[model samples]
Target chain A: MMKYYFSTEKMSVGYHGQPLIENIEIALDKGEILTLVGPNGAGKSTVLKSIARQLSLIGGTVCLDGKDVEKMSGTQLSQNMAVVLTEKLRTELMTCEDVAASGRYPYTGRFGILSDADRLAVREVMELVRVTDLKDQDFTRISDGQRQRVMLARALCQAPQILILDEPTSYLDVRYKLEFLSLLQELCRKKGLTVIMSLHELEFAARISDKILCLNGKYMERFGSPEEIFTPGYLSHLFSIETGSYDEENGTMELEPAGGEPKVFVIAGGGTGRNVYRRLQRQGIPFVTGILFSNDLDYPVARALAAEVIEAEAFEPITQTCLERAKKRLVECERVICCKDSFGTFDRANEELLAYAKHIKPQLIVQTNFEVIELDQKEQNKSQEQKDHDKFNSVTQKSKVENQNQTHNVRKEGIAPINQKR
Target chain B: MQHRRKMRYTAAFLLLGIGVLAAVALNVCIGTVEIPLADILSSLRGQTIQNERILWDIRLPRTLAALILGGALALAGYLLQTFFHNPIAGPFVLGISSGAKMAVALVMVFLMGRAVRVSSTAMIAAAFLGAMLSMGFVLVMSRKVEQMSMLIVSGVMIGYICSAITELVVTFASDAQIVNLHNWSRGSFSGMTWEQVQVMAGVVAVTSAVVFLLSKPLGAYQLGEAYARNMGVNIRLLRALLVVLSSFLSACIVAFAGPVSFVGIAVPHLVKSLLGTAKPILMIPACFLGGSVFCLFCDLLSRILFAPTELSISTVTAIFGAPVVLWVMIRRRQERTA
Candidate 1:
């Protein structure tokens, strides 16, 4: 039988003897990254703690290299596995080098003094994590990102075959998060290290992980390759994300579209409508976009945010029926926005529709830049003159009062103000 | 950078060693009846001089007691601080010395009442038991309260309780024994005989060696328990060893010289700052030397500042040590906000 590098069989874990997640099964090969993605309080840390032997297992066994971990001595287990926990390391007068050198504990002799070889190992690992410059700085005095790198260096100094991390990127900024994970990927490749960690960033998890485990506090919801687990509807359902849509193919997310009848019609194609669609969505204006090919670059976003979309098959000319539908949508819209700078032969129908829109709503034809024509000459003159400052202040004050009263009315109706404001 | 650090460590150790020798000499030479340096030197050469009895019987034992017990107290504080991961944790602050005091007092009073002499070994054993008891309470309280200040507050409360019980026992002692018990309980290194000095040296030497050997786990432990465990330290074993070793060291001090205040808490902090590093290998030996120097200085002050009518050792220690504790608290607060 082929041997798996690490596996858990019927493992159950929790605090104080009550199992919160049970019957967990995992298998991994060398040089693989396994990420646990789940809602908060979903037992990700508990599972990690059990495997690290920081917490007692409620049931079953975790095997490393076909040997049950429960049977190994602490020193043996430590020599094979290292962990970077979420707990803050608060030390007194400890240089970063001292902190990293402590990872040589299992290899040192009786007094725990480091030999020349051990010192070399510490130096190499610090270099690996790019923390050599911070060697003499106090561990407690460094930034969180620098401290995380030092901690990872400390873990690497253990020279373990398997590394476990608990939310290693929780406190890091965007740059450090990407750097830290990329470093992990490099270690996994160069050293054939098996990595198991829990990540809150679903996109990073999907991109970097060989396998993903979904946990829901009581049980394992799913476990498989990211491709199998990150299906379109699955991630949103798993996270109970009711207010946003998650795109599985690209691993991108979008907020829920504005709810109401289409107030604006966007005549866009070839990715030109994406920004306008998002801008209108941010402004809480429902919009209809039409005459977009099925394979248009902006199709996914338009599908996610637009209230109505008129789409034709990929590489096909705009159908007469689809053009009629777009013309009908254009009539219902108070304004038509044309995002196309130019049209090809296949989009002749879109050009015709644009002309129809100009004929029907002559003043409403705005280009993709979204600059509207000034229809009222007197209103435009009053806004353009600097002498209208007092008039602007009075109007702003009236609107502020009206908004306060509206919020008060909503509160009185017992609906939460957060939802109303959004 | 490495060479500079090595030089710093070497300089610190040399300075501390010189300081300890100076303090020892000053302690042995200056007293109510000061001896000349020449006479002191001759007496050390085994000559029978006019000040031989005074030097051999009183000054020598008391000086050695201060040095040995002082080192024990500081090492105990270092171990406790590492175990708790709190800078202010020590024998006195954690009530361990008071616990040992209570236990030794009970044994002394009980043995005296029964017309039996208590051996030094029995006294140390009883004191060790008491120290462990107080340590147990502190551990439980630490588990319940994560705040370092709260743990210290609870330890202070435990100290008060143990002191009150000891006071009640002392109040009922016979008149003949009251003076000795009172002087000991007030915390003094006076009346230390050569035999008692020998016993204390042996205890301190063995215990300090064990602490030195434990530098590895102690260093690992300084990062906090989770990382220490990841580094292959057996948490349970290390924790139990810490409790027992710290208790033993503090118990030896209480058994020999009573419950001296602040030496356990202040000397380690002073030593760590002086060295500018908390690496346990250097810190363990440095704290021992620092503690000896500190106690010798305080004991000398107690003996000569109010000559012939000596102050209790605790009074001298509190005068010099309490301010360090306050400074540590202020620095900790600043560190938190920063």
Candidate 2:
């Protein structure tokens, strides 16, 4: 409803006169990045393609700077907007430089010949995206990450008022993905270049986008800032994620937790129990882990992978009632595993819970970095003087219980002694 | 890299220009009555040399016809290639020429039977209609099958059907009419008149100029329809222009020379490789020159190869062009796999 640099007014788009998604309202001001996020086949691309005028709009209008997009002449529209498409750019005998130079199409002469200024613009954009070294290479010969950068360079050289991209980071590696997005963010901030794109990587999308549009069936389901759009249970519902859970605030995904538990109780606090919880999940051990504070670093992972997470309120001290509840859960477990060897003032509750597990004495293990400590209670109680520390040196503190039965093949310095590199 | 490309463009143009001059001279001089270059020049200056009539009336007209028609065919091929985004699309391959040939054959038969004369304009109109008909089928097939090879297969099928129909029409003609239709149907450059040469030159000149003006948009189109549209190319309008301009050029060629084969497909591919770029600004003129050179050589070869019995222009062109087509296909497959 608010006027912006680019806006779609009740636009309906589809194939063969059918409306796949209708009444889509999106408004982006200058120097903004709007990202579309949705499950596959939810018509994210259709909405994007329609916005770029690559697909004819089925109904309503798209406005660029208060001008009806469909009514603008080719030159008028092209100078204002450019798109990086998902379609494979099938080209022959074209260098990366040539592809980049083609971004000047709207400003070029009658024959699309680039003048010195246009050539300089191309070079500048290629440099801006750090693909200057690849300018002379054949576009199709480069790696996909390099190709994505080159494509970005091409779109940038257009000097458009609005840039539209579809899954721009889909082909990029992690390093380039961050670099590419930061470059776009820089353009938006420094040059006031507005960008609208779809991103499959929700993490990057959450970090980079100024506004996010959530799409599901039939329409734009939710549209707002990333803070508003990435609320709890939304992406799981939107993506129809049945087996796994998504951490909305952080945009991290976790596989479904093992069910029907009570074999192991893990006393984990701070960030120590994350790996142990995941390891137990992978082994299908169905462990219950907690007395984790709601704001603890491992609470989310425990919530995702643990059978039961005995949670405490954030910043709260160890209360007698919560400890009693934890003790009750630990009694039903066959064995107790403590992921941390030491607990400080903040995690003193975890230390107290670990002591209680040993006092009850069902079966207990103290977990450390790649080490699991097992106490044989009868032998230790019988000869505390002789067993002096239950501390016989066995060389490597092997977590053999976690290992699936393998004979030690060590010769010297733990090498199996293969002859050749091949 | 830019300077190297500039050098390649200059070299390609020079090469094509020299080839065109050599082929023209060879075609003009090495006919059945071997006219020397000096005598041919003198004949052009109205000196009335002994072999002047043969040089002027038969050799010169035929040579010019081959040059003009060849260029038109190649330019048409370039336009169609741009339109379809397929390197293999061309007038002859897509059955457009054969379609035109059929219409011309029908007109020739009906007019000759009625004891009436057919003007070059009337022949061109008929050819244009038939070309559009075949192009319609090709366009429909292109929409139905997104695969590039399937489009070519459908075009080739359309060509076969049109050729069959043309042959059927030729069978009903009188014995005298049969000889004329038979020679034209085989695709020859013989019996071309100066009037016919002038008309084709006029048509090709106008269409090629229009195509040259369209070079900027056509360059955008090379990236694909979506990008082209994003770049503010009026895709529908550009596509329509390519179809009309290409069909007109092919119509002009078929009206005069009766469906010369393979020059359309081969010349544009050859020129693009030579220039090392598909930038339409350079490609348009280069394709025209390359087509002229290709056709001139083929036309000249058709005359001298069998001596007293002249070969069809299609036969000589097919001998060279088909291999290039096969090479393009093989290379396309390799690139796709890679």
Candidate 3:
């Protein structure tokens, strides 16, 4: 068997006379992917930075391969270890390949030129990251997810025995998040590199990491596996939330909403209707919407999407036929909401549609105000009448501004609070 | 691979072509007589003695001075940029130039007192001493501060205090001595002799070579001080050595050309943009070549933009350089948003 590598003792790290993380001991055999999981501000990054020598230890020794880290010269240390940071790479104008090639700097000559071996290492890592095609692209111009992979390639090119990363998944979308963690996992296994990383995603950390280190509630919680660390008891206390369920298989925490449900009926036109429709669905509540102009984006979106909606006019005002159909549905809806008018003007039938919801005593959410409703009334009566753009602007735009602020009020009714994880 | 190598060769040839053209333009178009290029060429061929005194004795030296100063400042800027990982950083960020100016200032105020008598070599030596002294302080501070931002703040502090000291020195200088000091400080190549140009060229040439050799290590610096060390770079020693070499380059130029601005700060950015990469291997040469071209262009502009009365080289660079810097800032902001 290859000789094992381990951090010899419990070491505390501090900066400027204050300890960041203390009495923490971690050891790894070759090929172990150690994941540090914690809530925000848990000093996971400090631990990595300290071991990578980005930060000096306030106390204790960090021995790598049985050698004291502090005793090695910079070049010697670099030869032994590498780090990838959560912070975005700040450089501009370099190609992906160029950035990766910089990893060979420590191994190169006095002038730091790359040898053939250095070039090979850079190319190999680029291929490994599936970014061989992106090698020529400007690093700064690339997408955030691509940039993160490029950073990994750069780190790998250094060929360090130990690799440290801080929150590699923090900025990634879900798909990219899974992909990045998987890539890291692959790197550790294939290279037999001792990998250490800090991450915020609990489920992914639990699923992929070989060992999990939890920094939370002012204590270092070490677990041999993700199952041991991601318990409901551990997570609820960690986040200081009243109710949270840890989905062990998927590694997601389901939060209990703060307030009771709000009864909402939506009157929507165009696509302005989708957000409210989904919020209601996630809240486990029901809603009714209608007199949707058939050409409206919201009509199709709601039909194809969730929630019960009644349609009236395809290209014209809501007819009596559409309203009658919607009224039958409205018998069940507790409140009515109109997404802000796509066009300010409404037909006479839409006015009656609004009046029907008003008569039913359901809370009315109007996308527009009464002037457009009045113009539609005249159209229904076959009267020659006109309204200025300004009249429509005031009628349609003003109430909607008030309606936006009302969304906050609805949140207090606790339909669905804004998701803060993203 | 062969085709790419050929294309790179072609590109290099084009850059050299531009550099040579700019050199000639700056040469024939500057000085009191403002000799024509044809006359300059003829004089080189030994056909124009009437203009030889102006061309060979004055204009030639000035042109060479511009080339040396430009190349040196640009390389210094590139080194400092990579060293700090701050694009705004330059040779002057650590008050290296001001420190050099202070040394010259002290020499003038005390040793050469109103005489305007010191040789070009002595002034260069004094400036070198001053720049090196300030760089010494920065190197010490870099060892103490783990963060580059803090190190930059310390440099700014050093620069500010040095400027104050220079102001005090100026307050007591005689008018004639002040005139010499002001002209030197604002940057001028007017009276540069072959001897002075040779000295400046030697320093720039040697230092550029040293820096070019160190380009790979410097590239590692872009990843960061920590990462660089992890890769087996003796970062502490390399950083100190590079700082010293860069300070030496900047100081020699200051001694010869006065502290010409922007060439050290702006040229590296322009070169990086033009080359389309920040790979130090290419960037160092690009900076050197581009710096010389840029400064020579500024020198030419200073002479011709307003005929008879010349502007300072630093002033001309500021006029051109500020826009590039503003564009960089705006580009960075837009990038952050996206």
Candidate 4:
């Protein structure tokens, strides 16, 4: 039988008489998969090493099964808890069977001769980790993932009640990552090994961990079920990124750009519009791309994905023929998104096209500096650049402009729309 | 499984064969009156031979003495390294060699010049006694210092103190006694007799058997002290037994050849590199052969390098030993960083 509960008082740890991390209080129960999720240098590994008695606690006590952990001998501590460190073991020339047999250290007597019972225990644990077939091979020659499984097998040979792992999935690929988690889950469910691990992936931890310990600055920022700790506000604070929103029904966070969706009317050329097209499709926003010559990379991506495109002739300038089609499409769209290179040059005919859009004043969402369009005589004649740059300089000034000149109902999430400016 | 066992057997036989051939060649070739191999072989076959004095008196005793000392020092190095889990640890790490040198210095410089004229055998016994006494002090101190590095440092301090005492004693010695002491410090097997060989071989053979039986526990020790204890090994008993065994081995070799430096440190490392492991079963015999082979080669170099007026064997060994140690240290650092 294993004793699970300890005091909730925080503990302090140090190495070689110098303090490392402190004020960390945690309570672990049997049959629980608790994960410590933090970025590098957040001291997640320090906490685990302190619990396993691999490192000394400088100030506070670590009571295991209601007794001071420091008082117990190595054999006793090893029997209660096993540790899997991140070191790539260089103990080659030993077979897998030999490596696992070392876990019976506390049980064997002075001569190190194995008893029948010890041999049986080693075999059973080898089978448990499903590494029995690779038992005969030299440990070094095996793949890293297989070697990790072998290490887990050795830990199980100790028959430890608590298994502590540090970055167990760090070297694994996507497929192995899922399989490893499932294996740990099965072990926790069936054998009641109190599993504690650290992870880098947020999605994997949210899916598998029973309790998540989110470490940020010095203390744990949040410690609870994954649903409570993985909200938009908490994630935004943790990662310090701009876009963070959660979908309660899907149990996933939606990280879209600030100011909801821009009602973009994309004026893309060649296949420059493909990425924006798929991004809008996944985001479930309205958009249009085109004036694509017949054989542009963007034209096929837009066409194949059922995006409405205004097609034009291959290698042709933005003539009146293509402009008439684009003008017709631009009226229905709320904004115009153009790639910087859509127009061939500063031709007089393309200059007329820019004048027409300036007259309507749609929200033009372009990827690059549209010098051909911005430097057109028609846009300069309107003097829109100075007003546009000045109006976006401050939220207070933009809001005043938006309130005074409310001609469009664009419903932008956090920005002043083009038509709303006087 | 049978093939592995067979290969091990073949290796053991090969080591023994090479040891015997080298022992005969080195014994025959190196002496003031260099006996030919044919005459040496004939004398052994009980045929009346020329150069009988050279074959029996001068060469035979010295070569046998070298073999015994070489094998014992190597075995001692093997046991100490395995027990400590540190590749560089040696029997001399406990300062036993310095202690023995101190005792020999006291006998030659202080006692022998006065009314007490100690025999060579008595001086050998005195050196052996001094080494055991130092080992006893280290054993007592090891109980207090829980850390391995601290214990090693304590041993180093003991060596330093003992060397200081020896140097102080040397300041008052007569010139003849000083010359003898200088020769002893250089670690030679030149004037050894069959009587000394008879004494050393008995002690070495018995201790080797004991170390062979203790190999399994020593293997567990290479993992670590805590790991060895968890494996049900009695750490206290094994540590005491290993100390006594290695001390006896070191004492016996120092008694015969006067504390040859490199064999006790380098032989075990050479064996481990060859076997690519720390397992004692393979390491023990490999160390035994490698030690003998290394010492014999050093002995040969000492005689030939400066020929008729031979340089000390210790000088030759140090010339070779220092560089090898540096290389191993550099390689270990590279391994750790890698």
Which one wins on lDDT?
A: 1
* TM-scores (chain A) of the candidates: 0.86, 0.87, 0.61, 0.62
lDDT of 4 by residue, B1-338 (tens): 42574476567648755875776597567655666777777778999887887767767777777777787888987776665555565656668877888887886666776758666567667777888888878778777887767777887788788878877777667777777777776688778777777878788888888887787777766655644544445678999898778877887776556667767777777666666555566667767777777777777777667768777877877787767667767877775575
Alpha-carbon deviation at A237 in model 3, angstroms: 4.1
lDDT of 4 at A223: 78
Where model 1 places Cα greater than 4 Å from the true spot, the runs are A363-422
Candidate 1 local distance difference test against the native: 0.86
Q: Give per-residue CA lDDT, model 2, range B1-338, as digits (tens).
A: 77777888899999999999999999998967888899877877878798767887899899999998898899999899888888888999899999888889999999999989999999999999999999999999988998988998999999999999998988878999999999988888899998998898888899999999999888888988888887888888998988899999998989888888889888898898899988889999999999999999999899899999999999999999999999998998898788
A182-201, model 3: which lDDT tens digit per residue?
88878778888888898777
User: Could you give the CAPRI-style class of model 2?
Assistant: medium
Q: Across residues A96-195, which tens digit of lDDT does each residue of candidate 4 receive? A: 8777877775677655566899989998988888889988787766777887788788778888877888888889888878878888899999998788
| CA deviation > 4 Å runs, candidate 2 | A1-3, A362-422
Clashes of 3: 20
Q: After superposition, how far is residue A173 of candidate 2 from its true place, in Å?
A: 1.0
RMSD of each: 6.4, 6.6, 13.3, 12.1
- The per-model DockQ list reads 0.68, 0.74, 0.36, 0.15
Q: What are the per-residue Cα lDDT tens digits for candidate 2 across A1-422? A: 46788888899999888999999999889999999999998899999999888888999999989999999888887888888898977687999999988889988877778999999999999888889999889998998888888888888777889999999999788998888899899999999999999999999999999999988957889999999989998899889999979999877878888676356788887887787677666655677888899999899899888888899888878788888888898877656677676787877777888878777763444433334345446524533433334336332223222221111111111111111110
Candidate 1 residue-wise lDDT at B229: 77
**Residue-wise lDDT of candidate 1 within A1-422, one digit each (tens)?**
76788999999999999999999999899899999999999989999989998888999999998889888887898899999999987678888998888888899898887899999999999999999999999888899999999989888888899999999999999999999999999999999999999999999999999999999888999999999999878988888889868888777778899886675788888877777777677666678998889889888888889998899998877889999999998877655667776889998988998888777766653453334432234423433442345456977656445533442332233122222332
